[model samples]
Target: MDRTILKSQLERYRTPYEEESAFIDSFIDLTSDPLAYKRERLEGHFTASAWIVNRRRTHTLLTLHRKLGRWLQLGGHADGDENLIEVAMKEAKEESGLTSLDLVDSTIFDLDKHIIPERPHVPEHYHFDVRYILEADINEPLHISDESISLAWITFDSVVDMIGYNPSILRMLEKTSKSEILL
Candidate 1:
């Protein structure tokens, strides 16, 4: 897991969103350390999340984050892992209890920067989340982990309505809508 690899991947991502482009530039300009994922690094750590869709592509899995108490995608701190894709998949599997997930696309699907409020010992900081899309079976039995209060597979049309309107989720929905696997 090298910072150079992450930098190259971000550079290769093509998106119409100007904000994400800016985020990429900022991420590259900020630091060259692979340990930038650590919270102690402080400038803004790399986080990874998965926009997980079922094989039919009609539904997506979301978790009611226990700590955050919000309906959000499955993911967590990169925790020193420079391979964001692997981090995303690991979080997805850990949170959703889905053992069989296939990468829908190897390319980065979305980018977001959000503030995480201070909680107890953890200080408030920014999370530079790199998102990826994964495909799994909707019919598979899901086991909810302690990390989430609940987990549900929401229909594509009902996502924003169910989870609350989130720009990143909307962006991912738009991207997946145009993907051949989803079609």
Candidate 2:
């Protein structure tokens, strides 16, 4: 994995939240460690996620994540992929089963660092998730992968009231709501 790309993106990325900004710095610090992109790095590892929206950008696609059991954005482990954009795109397609998806921009859309609870086999760790904006046809069919219990296109207006609301997701929601290109 090319750490330069990740470092470059982090240098250019900006966030209103001080917490996210701290995450950005920590992500940049990870660039020095070659193992940072690998899931084997039990301390923490890179993840890629898609803030998927419809063509109109009125709603966002979320999955009832099977492992985490929460309605969250489409994404997964980077698994040593340096091309974070491709990672995000692949996760979106695999999770949503949407063949046609367009990346709104190559630039970073959001950054989040969240703890993953320890599972039976997997130990607790942090996922330094890098997110990007993606657009798909709302009319297109969606198939739920085994990773999710269900998939739904939740309106941007109603995401706040939804059950299993995540603060990190809400941060992305705030960013999406303010982005002129998104709305």
Q: Tell me the number of clashing residue pairs for each predicted model.
A: 0, 0
Per-residue lDDT tens digits for candidate 2, residues 47-150, read 99999988876899998899887889999988888888999999999998998799998888998988999988789999989899999998889999999999
Best by lDDT: 2
In candidate 2, the residue pairs with backbone N, CA or C atoms under 3 Å apart (3 or more residues apart, or in different chains) clash, namely none
Residue 54 alpha-carbon offset, candidate 2, angstroms: 0.9
Q: What is the TM-score of each candidate against the true structure?
A: 0.93, 0.95
Q: How accurate locally, in lDDT, is each candidate? A: 0.84, 0.87
RMSD (Å) per prediction:
1.6, 1.4
Candidate 2 shows a clash count of 0
Angstrom error of the Cα, residue 3, model 2: value is: 1.8
